[model samples]
Target: MMKNYITKEVLPFEGERRDLANVAREMFNRKMTNVAGGNISVKVTPDENFSYDEVIYEKGHDYLLMTPTFMSEAWYAKLNPSQILVIDLKNGKKLSGEGRLTREINMHEEAYKANPKIHVVYHSHALNCMFWATLGQDMPNLTEVTSVNVPLGKIKCLPYRTACTKELADLVYEELIKLGDKSEQNIFLLNSHGVLITDTDLHSATEVLETVEWNADIAYKQAIFKKLGIIENYQSCGNSLTI
Candidate 1:
């Protein structure tokens, strides 16, 4: 059942679609995620043509503008605005687009429903971040930049659950609910998987992702330095050195 809803009706949020594509390219180029690693999405209120699912999408929830499935493997970084899928978040139907919706759609929906203020959900399998994920440990606040920039207190790692499953989505939803309404940002590491980020907008989400990845890189280096017994020697030398 290959479903494609190429529509003549003007797609609702053309500007948002363009931004999504551009951001996708930027992230790909930056190596924030690999070709087949992750997904991004934004919550949006649909136009008059669509109606909210009163039961599932309570409080006027509507649609999602998200990166389509296979935008990574089949399409790579060459995403176009036309490829961004418009999805009915309430009922999980394709509203308009030539591409199929991502299977992780449920993850984004649960994130949005858990907190109405969160407008973006960005997930990625960045290499440095995956280092910590592989170990199934929380990424400690490693860098001064992360401490100042990333609003989330601690980077929690969730237990491994199969990807694109309702169980995974529910797990994320429960974590988001725990963050409470006032929280502005969230970053989670899926055990032996990747990172999930939520924020008020794409800009904030991507910014936090970049900073967190950088922090992860620094964390790796810090571990190496500590193991090599460089920290104590470097500290001792710093007291006598003049520059």
Candidate 2:
């Protein structure tokens, strides 16, 4: 069952769906996820003055605004504000928007249940991130940013859990709660599925998304080098390749 926990403060959503579209497009353009793969969401306190079909909403109540689950081929990249859904996470109710959310919503809810500070979540099927997930190993830190940013050594690659199941969500929730407030470590590599990241804002969430993938790519290259017996000496990535 969906439930609400301690809320730090009410941050009502002020922008239109296009605001979410910008980030979603960025992830898509960067080849972070397939057209229908990743999903993005944000928790917000509904505006008291706003009403749905004549029913007014309470300002302090938390609601999730997210993208549509099923979309036409081109719609994923050209997402519109009208395509976003606003749902009441408390009782699993839909407040607005057309179509259902991605099955990954369960994991997103679990993240919110674990930490009140998290306001946004991005789950993508990025190639590199998913590559690490299949191995069930901590991503090697060839770069300092990956070590410090994904401070848990590497992004946690969750064990095999069926997508949309309570077990999957709970594991992700518990894993994140243990980290306390390190929202950047929000990255979660789902076993045989994909990746998830929780953040207080879109900016920081997007920032780490690129870094994690870069680290994963670097690790892949290192593995290849080791296979070919290129070099045993340390190859430090002194600068961030987070572009």
Candidate 3:
């Protein structure tokens, strides 16, 4: 069920709300996500608006400021600050904003539970990423920028699972636990679904998403060359992508 919190006629975290909306616009403009559905969230500290004892929000210091569900189908790139919703990280209840909560809320919540340091959780239906996702293959690190920015190595493609199901969310959480802060491997490609990127901040997360998508495009071209025999044993520049 969806829950709503009174903001005492005040909207808290105005700056964060604006930033999140801006990122959503940028993502839509870049085609990182589409009307098919995707979600972005940032862990935040609540203000006085959460001071009530009746609300579940006082249970935790952190909350999730997330893009609304159906954002793409309804508003697409025109998302505004008022559309971003606040969720209580501890109880998973909608705390503020008028927008409906995303069905993938569990994906972001479980991820935060797996690693408290993860501040941003970005899921997208990028065209190239979706290509690899539909193909059910992991995205190899063909671009040097990906190798440098995503040190955790190749973008893994998890087995297929129905979207918005606990099974899918749990699977993502398990993978995150396995990674466990050992490296920068924070990207996951959901089989037949989309891409998931996590990071300590929004900028870094979005930057890595762009880099990975670019690599995915390159991988697609590489596959075409292989099948067409255009390059006759074509191989990547093998570090030529480096400066």
Q: Where does model 2 exceed 4 Å of error?
A: 1-16, 46-48, 71-74, 148-153, 183-185, 237-243
In the range 17-95, model 2's lDDT, one tens digit per residue, is 6688777877788888886567888888744445445334566788888877753244766676666777788976776
TM-score, every prediction: 0.84, 0.83, 0.87
Position 207, candidate 2: lDDT: 77
What is each predicted model's overall lDDT from 0 to 1? 0.78, 0.73, 0.81
TM-score, cand. 2: 0.83
RMSD to truth, every model: 7.0, 6.3, 4.9
**Ranking of predictions according to TM-score:** 3, 1, 2
Model 1 per-residue lDDT tens digits across residues 1-243: 732333324445678988998999899889998977589998877332332222122234467888888877887757877788877777788766678877888888888889888889998989899999999888766555566545566878998889999999999999889889644588899888799998888988888889899878876776677669676321111242110
What tens-digit string does per-residue lDDT give for candidate 3 at 131-150? 99998888767776777645
Ranking 2 against 3 by TM-score, winner: 3
Model 2 residue pairs with clashes: none
